[model samples]
Target chain A: MATILVADDFHENRDVLCRMLRLVGHSTISAANGQEALDMAQEHRPDLILMDLSMPIVDGWKATAILKTTSDLRHIPIIAVTGHVTPDEINRAISAGCADYLAKPVDFERLLGKVASLLGDTQRPPFLSS
Target chain B: MKLSIRTKLLAALGLDLALMLILGSFALNQMSAMNEEATFVAAQTIPSIDTVNTINDILLSYRNLQVEYIINVASADKLRIEGEMHHLEEDMAKAFITYDHFQLDENERATFEQTRAGWEQFVTATHTQFIPSNRDSNTGNVHPSFSRLAPLYDNLLSHVRQIKQQSQQRATTALGRVRAAYDASRLVILSETTLTIVVSAVIGLTLSSNIARRIRKLRDATMAIAGGDLNQTVALRGSDELQLLANNFNLMVASLRQQHLLLAQRNTELSESLETQRKLMSDLVQRKQAEEAADRARATAEAASQAKSMFLATMSHELRTPLNAILGYVQLLHLEAQIRGNTDMLPDLERIRSAGKHLLTIISNILDFSKIEQGKMNLEIDTFEISSVANEVIGIFSPLAHSRGIDLTLICPPEIGLMRSDAGKVRQVLFNLLSNAVKFTERGHITLTISHEYHSGKAWIFFSVADTGIGINPEQMGRLFQAFSQVHHNTFHHYGGTGLGLALSRQLCQMLGGDITVESETGKGSVFSVCLPADIGTVQATRQTHVLHTNGNLPRHIPGSVPSLTPGEETAVVASPTSMTQRDA
Candidate 1:
């Protein structure tokens, strides 16, 4: 299992996404905002990050751009997560150094699949296969 | 002369009359002189000549009687001769007295005096000599004393002849004077008549030609005015009628020229005003056009502002409240419930999940309807099998239909091959119709029929949902597909729906180059059909034009609280397929 970061402004959304990642056999650390997410990433150096684009401070797009520019944290894959699902928003996310994009009311299965694929695991995670 | 035509004409006539009068008076004077000469020749000259001739004839008769006495032989003859000789002497004295009664000139009087003297001598000689001779004659045959009487008788006869010749000469001279006077008067009259004619002709010619020349000048001036030359003036020098006419014509021409100047000035002013009016008209037209353009720009800006507010409203109120935390927590709870093997709670969790999804669907409907209204919806065309879509739709409705105790069937031919269209919208339309069918029908069967066919060299796919349900009345059919309009308002509480499914479905079908139609019989069943082009790309080109035309006619503002769907709803829409898959799993 890999260490993952989940950032969201809503506590319930963060709690549910963290739970879903743990259920899928991945260990996840959570942040309530993009600034907290950056601090958590710098502290733990998580293998992956689930970035929520709309946040109170240091929005996901700025956080991703900052992390990608930093030498030490630039190698970590980031999957931008947000409620905004327009094509323009998705393109913006991808172009802002995000490894992938996911619209909210997040499908856990697709989220797990994208997480595993970015981590170089081809098979579906054990919780999803079960 | 400063004469009028009437005065000049009268003067010319008067001159002719005076000349004629002068000729008449002169002719009268000459005639009176001629008449006096003729009277002298007729009365005085002829009477004197006749009386002198009468005296000369008596002397000749006395000589003849004396010769008769000398030749007589009887005494009775001698006595008769003596009585005749005595009567002859008495008659000679009476002739002398008659000669003294005539008027005579100086030469005539001298000639008459000699004749009278000669007459008295003859009378004495006749008494003395002739009587003695007659008495001395004894024998009636011969008288020796008759010789003395012969010379005396001859001398008296010669004197009487001279007096008669002198009187005849005076009569000839008087006649000659009358003839010469007549010739002189005739010459005077003839010359006067000729002079009158020549002078009259000269005067008439001068007057008429002068009048005619002046009239011609006036006529030419009038013609010049008529020809548009206002500078003409008729100049005349006399005070005649023609000159007066010329002066009046000059006045008239001057008046015409003044009026012409006034009219020309008025025309220039009118034209200037017309030009100003035309410029004002053009300015007004341009201002009107500019105002219209400004109005159009304001309308566009207002539309954009309305769209932005609608998005914000939907995000703040409709989307963020229930969709973000509630649906996410519910899904987490559903997963947890299933993981914990809480069989009793699983149903309630599923109910909550379904209700959350239903709310999501309603929000999606509003968003889609707004996008369509704003001409923002675009087709995501793909090639997919109709059978699979039909099967999927049927599977979705089958459980609901079974729970409602209604038969659900799919009539899709195997030959219904791959169709090209917006698969998501197509599936959504089919889902909307099937869900409606399941919600409305109590017990009767519902059938979904899918077919593809060639229509005039173009491929078309038709999806029809026939439901035995509470059929709609004819009057409600008109507004059936209108957004937010529900036909069965009385049963709205009993049958819950947002009334946007049919409207959204019809709009989605049209965006895919298709249409939706419904046929129903009251209290029996309803059949809703959707027809779409197999290859939506071909019609998408034309559909864009249709969308723009609709956009032009759209109202400036769309009313209602379900204003627009925000990005939150878009996420729900994007997550829908996965949600369905998970629900099926």
Candidate 2:
């Protein structure tokens, strides 16, 4: 299992994200804001970061830019989570340093799929529950 | 003479008068002395000589009468001899009295007195001694008496002769004194005349050299001033009225020179300003006409734009609101299908969402064009990385191009940097261009070049999209940017576009203070170049402009005098053979 950081300002959204990761058999650490996410990711050195765009106390763009520039943190893959996406904002996120992105309310299948691929997990798993 | 003609003439006259006075007085003194001498000779010398000669002749006549009486016998004859003697005596007395009328010397007076006494003695002897009655009446006796009377007469004659000689000597001496006085007066007159002539000549020369010369110089200076040569001035000579006149002339000329210079300069300035004003007036007239034309156009545009704004306002709220609701419900259904683990409904929900999004895109494009036409579109300006915008536009179309078997690439030369403009508008335009490129391009490559040019202090960023695909013909290209116009009747059907992309893109480019142009040919390729105005405060112009292709090969050089590109610009190639259909993101 790969370690992943879930960053969100909303408690429910963070819990849901963390729970989804745990259910996929991946270990998860949760943060309430972008700064907390950066601190925790540096402490734990997670394999991937799921960064929320809107957050208080150092937003996702700045935190992502900070992390992408750090030589040690540069190795981690990041996926942006946002409610709306425009070409301008997309370019901003990409330039500031996100590797991939997903639109929310989170599509767990796509989210899990992107994480699994970044972690190099070749074993396929059923993403949807009946 | 106070350095004046009047004074000099007076001086000459005065000198002449003085010379005349000297000559006249000398002649006057000489004439007075000559008159004295002539009067003395006439009154004394000649009269004294005549008295002396009269006494001498009277004495001789008395002696001869005495001799006659002595020889006579009658008493009456003797008596007549006595009377004749008395008459001789009386005549001698009158001659002695004449001596008193001359300027006589003492010697001449003494001589005259002795002559008168001697004449009286001779007369008595003749009357008494020679004719005595008691004497014997013999003739021999009369001879002795006559001899005695003759001796006395001879003595008186000798005395008279001595007086005449002395008087004549006095007259000669007076003549010599008059001759000396005449010679002295002549010498004085001759010398004074010579002196006056020399003085007059010298005064004339002085007048010519000083006053006359100064006057000539003043005339020359005045003439020069009249000829517009203000530099000339009179050189003053003597300190006099003429000099004062020269000084005043110099002052007049100096002031005139200043006025003349000022007037000439003012005249030149006036003409120059008049010419400038004339040119400016013509330019203003032309400008007024142009402004009138522009106002007319603007008024018509504003009227049409008002109508367009009303339409766009109705469409945006009416259309976008419902479209958003539709997309929202489709997205909710998509999420619902995932949550329920309904894999069968997921694709349908996704299709619904995709269709909604397509419709949204068409609606958005139409709205954008309507906003532009209405002049309601405004740029929200900010600073953003142009390269990143370009990259993002390219990135969004890369998968589509890859799916179509097209090679996609982007290049932002290093010389370019951040731009302060409406990034969203740029992204929108680039999105339209790249999407159109990918949508039309089926094979070969798609290139998006980002370069900048600096000209006349303004920087322009050029984003060009060239594609090798189903190209447009020359006939269809003319209507490319018309709203909702398609290249062919079936182009919209085949390409699946609202055909508003290029139209909106061109208008959007104009919104960002630039323009969009296109080049295309049938069965070949097409290029859409969107030029954007950029603030060069933080951007450097690129040295070479190049188009990015998947193989790092530049697109064909444009049809103009544009210089060739450098070999060292950076380009990102996406030869990723990804497969994407309407089903995938």
Candidate 3:
């Protein structure tokens, strides 16, 4: 299983995301805000990072920018999770160093697919695994 | 002299000639009268003196004969002689008186007076002797009387002789005096005739010469004036009124010369001023024309600006509709790939879709802003249920909100009426607000509230989206509704939205005579409100209240079995293993 980090300010959203990741047989870590997520990323060095864009202390855009520029963390793919997925917002995420974006209440299947595709060589279990 | 001066001079000469003629004629008339009177006196005196001398001679002869007859005859003869003597005495007395009164001057008067005395003595002696004898006797007495009277006759003859002598003397003296008087009268006639001739000749010559000289001067002056030499003055050399006339003519010519010079100068000035005025008028006309041209150009430029804005709006609409289809299909494809476990193409497809969508949104914003500038955006008003619209917008956003642990809620009063507005625009506005709430809120609830009120006989529908999220600052609020404006600089960077939704919503509200407003505190949350007019006739059914409960407390997903790739496999496969392996690679 590929190790992943999920950063979100809301507990319910984090729980739901964690449940979906476990169903697919991926090990996941959770953080409440962008700063916590950054600390978790540095500490764990997860294969992929799932970022919630609107957060206290540091937003997903700043966190992504800092992570992409850091030498040790630059190779990790970052995906933005947001509620409003307008074209301008998607482009902004890409420009801010996110590998891909998913609009929130994110579809379980789509999220799993994006995580799988961004991970490339990292094998993960199917999302519907019993 | 000028013409008038010459005229006056000639008139004076004419007057002088007339006076000379009158005086000369009067003198001639007096001289002729004197000549006639002298001729008449000379002829009458000579004829009277001859007659007197003849009478005196006859009287002397008759006196001698009468004396002889008186001495020789008797008394009868004496008496006859006495009668004859009386007659002779009367005759002699008349002759003596005539001779005395005929005296010429001192030289002729003495001879005439002596002749008269001798004649009177003879007459007296004859009368005394002849009268005495005639009274006595006849023939005898006549003889005695004749002898006595012979001596007396002789004496009388002597007195007669003396008388003849005196008569002769008187005659001679009278003749001499008459001759002298005739000589003096002839001398006077000759002197008068000579003086009349000389005076007439002198006056005629003087008058004729003066008139001729004046006429010549007048002719010369008239010629000079006709030759255009107006400056030349005719010299008037007389003290007559002709000099006054010449002075007046010179004054008239001077005045005419001054007037001519003044008139020429005035004409030149008038022409120059007219030219200047004409130039000024033309300049004014040209300036007005230029101003009119500029005004026309300004109007044309304004018209072009309006046309350009209209073109942009139409092009944006035409372009965005197709872009929407492209992006929507691409998103669907990306989701389908993930569900099928074919995730290798997901990243490239998402990139292409996002890039297209981003360009599309920029085009849409530019078009919308242009439409607003041109005042061409209009509302499509329709009647719709407020609750239904709210539910639809909420449904679209609920999944997103749920994933973020944001509680999204809809609060519509059961008594709320159906709203009348542009349903499409209202939906767009609500959808933007609700979605923004869901995106911004992380741990807090987002609510869509709907209410209705009556004001001034019109139903007003008020809708609001409130969220407990990171709210906007007051400073950023002013720019919140401007096109392409984001509340926070990082909003576009973090949240994915075009940023044109709020601006378009505000424009839509303004079209419907309504507005959108916001109330928020930073770090707490935000509430965006929209007020719209409700349709009068549409009625909404009252909502039924129910106690909603969920058995699993977790959001449910569709539970149909996942299609398996291998028929014999017991576990439901999400995707083919080979495709999953290709995605992982």
Q: Per-prediction DockQ, in order? A: 0.22, 0.03, 0.02
Model 3 iRMSD vs. native: 11.4
Cα lDDT tens digits, model 2, B1-585, are: 355567777887798888888778878888898898888777777776776677667766766776666676566776777788778878877776766566556876677667767766866765577666413444534567677766676777777778777876777887888787777777777787788788777877877677767888888888888887999888786567788898898888888888888999999999999999999999999999999999998788767666665575556435543454455456555655777778799878877876766776776666555555544455677899988888887778777677667778776787689888889888988888787777666667778888777645676777777677556666776667766566665666665776677766756655455667766555666667776668523333321121112121222323332222322221322222223211000
1 against 3, candidate with superior lDDT: 1
Task: Specify the poorest-scoring 10-residue window by lDDT in model 1 chain B.
Answer: B576-585
Give one digit per residue, the lDDT tens place, for model 3 in B468-583. 77667788777677655666656776765556777766665555555677766676666777766676233222111111111101111112211111222211111111110000
Off by more than 4 A, model 2: A1-130, B1-3, B71-73, B131-142, B149-152, B219-228, B268-276, B279-585
Q: Candidates 1 and 3: which is better by TM-score? A: 1
- Chain B TM-score for candidate 1: 0.50
**Candidates sorted on lDDT, descending:** 1, 2, 3
Enumerate clash totals for all models, in the order shown: 2, 3, 11
Docking class of 2: incorrect
The prediction achieving the highest lDDT against the true structure is 1
Instruction: Give each model's whole-structure lDDT.
Output: 0.75, 0.70, 0.63
Q: TM-score for every candidate vs. truth?
A: 0.59, 0.39, 0.40
